[model samples]
Target: MYKAACLVLALFAVALAVPSTYDTEHVWKAGNLSYVVPDNAVLGGFDPYGFNTYVGRVIYANSILPARVVVETGVAYFNTETLSSKLLVYDILVAERNVNYVWVRSFDGFYEKGAVAVGTTNKNERVFCCRAKTDGGVLIGTLLLSQKLCIIKHETLALRKFDKYEVLVAQAKGNGTLY
Candidate 1:
């Protein structure tokens, strides 16, 4: 009887040591970019360095990007939970048009790459979507353009895709964004 009681105590202790899936103070932020999981949403594991991407569903995403750009991708549903609108596959999407490169950070520390096609606009912003894989599935999204500049003057620039394991640490150091 004493051995069983001790085992229960050990199990309880381990449970307490594990991090909670929901944290009110857990906010993913990077360089004028920030994201907060909604109270009704369940947040999965997030990256520790650079743009910490997190997977979850928001009741309503109120412009998480810079310059108040609002986007609604689709419904986010978990195992048995009811579907919620605004499924945020990746928490943050960064595109540097000057270098003609696109970088996306996922909730589980995974990254995706894609090329940016120069858009036909006054600002000359690139109009393209980035796709990244997550534990759940593939996430397709686009980035908001901040400015328009024709530095390269090219229609489309080829972007090098990196494997999730290969660019894990390098992405944190601000490398592998451009080809």
Candidate 2:
């Protein structure tokens, strides 16, 4: 009986040592859109100097018909030299209503406020919009789709129209490549 109990305890300890996976679910009622990040979607690793790093891809879909509309790939890194963590998001592609567009909001390092929006073939139709803040981390933003535009600011969600004055800013400050 003592040996059996010891074996059970060892197995439990091993299970507890394993890292837990992340699963995210986001919903937008006004746009009838839902974004799901499945468990084990992100793969993590360590650099030669023992810095932590992760890479993942997230797919956004329409709730009603369950069609894929957007895909985003992001990379997160923890630098031991600076003792800081940073996330770099790349390849934000949107496909809706038979129209496809690429959003250019890629940023390397950390940022306080960033916004990216993509529209369909029609000039007045907006497919989606994403806002990122350092306080809340990544994957925390409002997703607008299907002709509906929603804006989430400071945790308050509102349905609003796309601003015509909004512009896309691409700043290349360092010697890094822009994709």
Candidate 3:
């Protein structure tokens, strides 16, 4: 009886030591997962200004200041001629502080860390995600950072300010390269 009890305790300890998929630390580390923002929804699917259009690859719009573009790398901007033909793919980075929130990275390693603010430059603080549910009983992808959506500031993308904007929820697509 004593040996059995000891074995049981040992097994329990081992199980406790094993990391869970939802473990905060485990999510913080980058994994073999990638996602694409095929399109976005706004105002309960009353998408105007082509917010529901395809998001394309990252480009340095300004040649004079390359760093500026790098700083604003995470979100997609709209230029029908420039961004229409391509799609933007991002890698998932779970937030260290809150596993629920996530950060996205561009193919060139630019993170969508909110609206490129002046003071909130810390990477950890820029975690964003879509709300699980909304008033319309829809899984709307309102990509929020610090509870605010950043657009228009950099011509990244345009949507009504008060309305929630949706993002394609990132799922585990296996270790794949983001195009």
Candidate 4:
């Protein structure tokens, strides 16, 4: 009886030690640019780093009212350039391993599929979604990887198609998103 009780206690402790990926403290990543949704008037703000800049570090999403995300045909994009939409809400449809299927709430209070587009640019680069059905394929949080988080794929988390630019979920350093 003591052994069984001890085992249950041990298992409970281990489970508590596991961190949840749904934690909003972690920011989104695409290539070298950390997606930092600011808590300002801008709906969707860009990183201080230029589109071609690589800061070589993780930038947190430090906003209480970050820009709302819109997913069209599995591709994700921001509704506006500012972060003031009360209708913008996100929910994790499913969580697997260290990854999760992130769903964005719609204007009608419905969640839609969110995804990343790879190689949208003719140069075989760029992670953001621009055109539809280009060489730059759409990636989804619904897609799972069998290997390490490298090489952004049709269902990957990284930003670029290839190279060292990997998409990953970055945890904030204390000063992160409230939600």
Candidate 5:
């Protein structure tokens, strides 16, 4: 019982403290994991460095400067078996630029190359999926997904969307891709 009490207290502390600020409502509901976003955030269109660093709930496009566009991401699943995650980054200049959203199979495995397995498309688009191997191991580095306009972007328990703002389109949507 003491261990259970400690665990509950730890969870409470994290809930009260993890959200350092109130840019957005720092929500985690119904299996959707999101970082908090500011209400009046301005998602600029720029990403010089390739990694996403969060300033509160929204990701910072650049460490020195704030995000050109306020963004959030989360993972989803059908149940307790199948699983996937996407990093839905967005921008204001382009509405949703550099959208590096992808879905993948949750597993306890290793892969040398990325899992950008989107093939059989005869469209004219450029995509580059690379990796960043630092001390943290390999990470999804480059992003290159079909630039299809998601005209009817909606927020669902299964889809990642911008918090506090009703967005129309996204940058990318992948089923699975490893950096």
Candidate 6:
């Protein structure tokens, strides 16, 4: 009888200790330029280091907001098969508040790069999103786990500054497959 009473109390205690909040649905991914278009994603084709030439864009439902992204993958080692790689860059989407930050990642992310050259970019990085005279600013962020056969770097953007120049960390994704 006493053990039964204790078990009931333990159950009641657990019920009270548990916080009432929904944490399961908040998991999200770091916005990749890949998310820009639903069906128009350009697979792969471009110079590994060419800046604007490898870029892409997506016009969202808002109609007024134009989104742009880019992906690049190649071997800089220019070495033999063992040392070759796939480079990538593109528009990284982030959920933002208002227009100031077209996107800001308010939730937590299980960020995993589909791939990277030197391995994972989980290393913290300084991301600078800038522009000329229009709505412009910079961002401070980091790169995380990159695991995929094809290592690629993708960057997404929607800038007010047309002629401004910015430098970002060059990351790559590649295939470790042997054919």
Worst 10 residues of 1 by lDDT: 147-156
* TM-score top scorer: 4
lDDT of 5 by residue, 76-110 (tens): 11111112223343221121233343323221122
Backbone clashes, each candidate: 3, 0, 4, 10, 15, 30
Candidate 5 lowest-lDDT run of ten: 75-84
Cα deviation of 49, candidate 4, in Å: 26
By summed lDDT, the worst window of 10 consecutive residues in model 3 runs over 62-71
RMSD (Å) per prediction: 17.3, 19.1, 17.7, 17.1, 18.1, 18.2
Rank list by TM-score = 4, 3, 1, 2, 6, 5
Off by over 4 Å in 1: 2-27, 30-82, 86-179
Candidate 5 residue runs with Cα over 4 Å from true position: 1-125, 143-179
For model 6, residues 23-120, the per-residue Cα lDDT tens digits are 12111122343433323222222332342221221211111111123332211111110222222322323222221111212212222222111111
lDDT of predicted model 2: 0.28
* lDDT string, candidate 4, 1-179, tens digits: 99999999999987655431222332333321133433221112122121211111111132111111332221232211211122223321112334332223222111113333221111222222121111233222111122212222222222332212222222223443212
Name the candidate, 3 or 4, with the larger lDDT value.
3
**lDDT string, candidate 1, 26-98, tens digits:** 2322211234433322122222121223233222222221111122322232110111123334332232233
All models: lDDT?
Answer: 0.27, 0.28, 0.26, 0.25, 0.25, 0.24
Clashes of 4: 10
Per-model TM-score versus the true fold:
0.22, 0.20, 0.22, 0.23, 0.17, 0.18
Worst 10-residue lDDT window for candidate 4 reads 50-59
Q: Model 6's lDDT to the true fold?
A: 0.24
